[model samples]
Target: MSHPTADRARQLLDLHTQPEILVLPNVWDVVSAQVVAATPGVHALATASHSIASTFGYPDGERIPLDLHLDMVRRIVQAVSLPVSMDMESGYGHPGDTARRAIEIGVVGGNLEDGMRPLGEAVAAVQAVMDAGRAAGVDFVLNARTDAALRADPQAPRSSVIEEVITRGRAFLDAGAPVVFVPGLVARDEIQEVSDAFGPRKLTLISVPGASLPARELQALGVSRLSTGPFTQRVALTALQDAAAEIVAGGTLPAGTRPLN
Candidate 1:
């Protein structure tokens, strides 16, 4: 039972030369994972906690049980040939045990957010988890996420944002994170500043909206990875809602609207 896909994912992390950003599209289920894998140059696939939780009729705040989350990861790995990365929200347990379990289940890498935890403690937790995975003979890419922008009010000062990201990122890197992800970033200057601060020592993953800069532009800014988060899931859900509303209002189904297979 050699897991070539899992091994390939670990190798992909080593294949980075420059920043050479890999834009990982987040998938909610097996079908979405398969479809994204069929696309050109998609090195790896990531799962969105928001998408997974919503699909199960639960909100995104860890309402879904650990058993359910592991099941989702197992099914996605079985469904796709590409390397799979999971959104293991807070690693699901104590750092060491959770990382060991995730590696055993075949998630090549994961995104762990430092949500409200002090920077030092979050870094230690991430390090412990990463060490556990490495000790299990699996190379794990712990993409530490700093949710400062997402958690803070829109009017929060720029100084606050910079300080928070820097402080948290330093801690996560010290703990052995291969990359740091900053979500909700929009401006080119901000992206550049963050990347510059991190430099070649670590990868900086950015989540950009479709309405924002194009993919080439993001890569030009030295983003090591770009993700869309749950945007695709949101789009799909919105379209379904629109069609359902039409049907409920005695209107015919839209011409291009086909039932999901």
Candidate 2:
């Protein structure tokens, strides 16, 4: 019999190849995971480090202990049948070890951030993650990320930033990441340029609310995946805040609120 997680990993990998853009509304916990997995069209799930951290009362950037973070991931994996990927923020200072632990808990894939680390170091991190997947007998979907667009110097020319993104993105792909995530590159022309540089269906993108293009437009640009990084949780929290405010001001909870858990 096939390893269950291996099967899930393969299924997750296959989603990237289909003509439809793989849309992942990143979740923070079991309830969110269950809700997204229960959605009609969602094929897989991914965790948002920022949201997960917030849910646990910590700030982002891996402020939560590695053990604590992996514990949450383990619960999420147990809570859903769909393949789940983690946002391994900068690998928590040890890319390979963190991935190995995540895999041991049934996580089939993850996003590894570069954070504008040295090119050689970033490439090695990608290789380390894929290596861990191999040792675990799973084809991990490594969505290698370069924060070039986010970390770019304010005074730097836009072309230079694009150059930095392409440079790191190419290196990440060459090192075995299935897709390169350019998180802050939202413009049509720039998206087209990066997609062209990376060839069809090799680039993955993050959708910032009010900033990203529509899924159809991203698909037309030849992008392979669109991840809603932390926005899903943010939207949920926004609704919660509004509801709380209403209750404090003599208003009742909205009758339309759906119980997801």
Specify the highest-TM-score model's number. 2
lDDT of each: 0.76, 0.93
For every candidate structure, what is the RMSD over all alpha carbons to the true structure, in angstroms? 2.6, 0.9
Which regions of candidate 1 deviate over 4 angstroms? 1-6, 15-19, 153-155, 201-211, 246-261
Expressed as tens digits, the lDDT of each residue in 1-261 for candidate 2 is 999999999999999888999999999988889999999999999999999899889999989998989998899999999999999999999999999999999999999999888899999999999999999999999999999998888899999999999999999889989889998899999999999998888899988888889999999999999999889998998999999999999999999978776
Clashes of each: 1, 0
TM-score of 2: 0.98
Worst 10 residues of 1 by lDDT: 201-210
Candidate 1 structure quality by residue, lDDT tens digits, 146-241: 887668777889868877787777677777788888776667887777777766535455455554667677778777777777887887778879
> What lDDT does model 1 reach?
0.76
The candidate scoring highest on lDDT is: 2
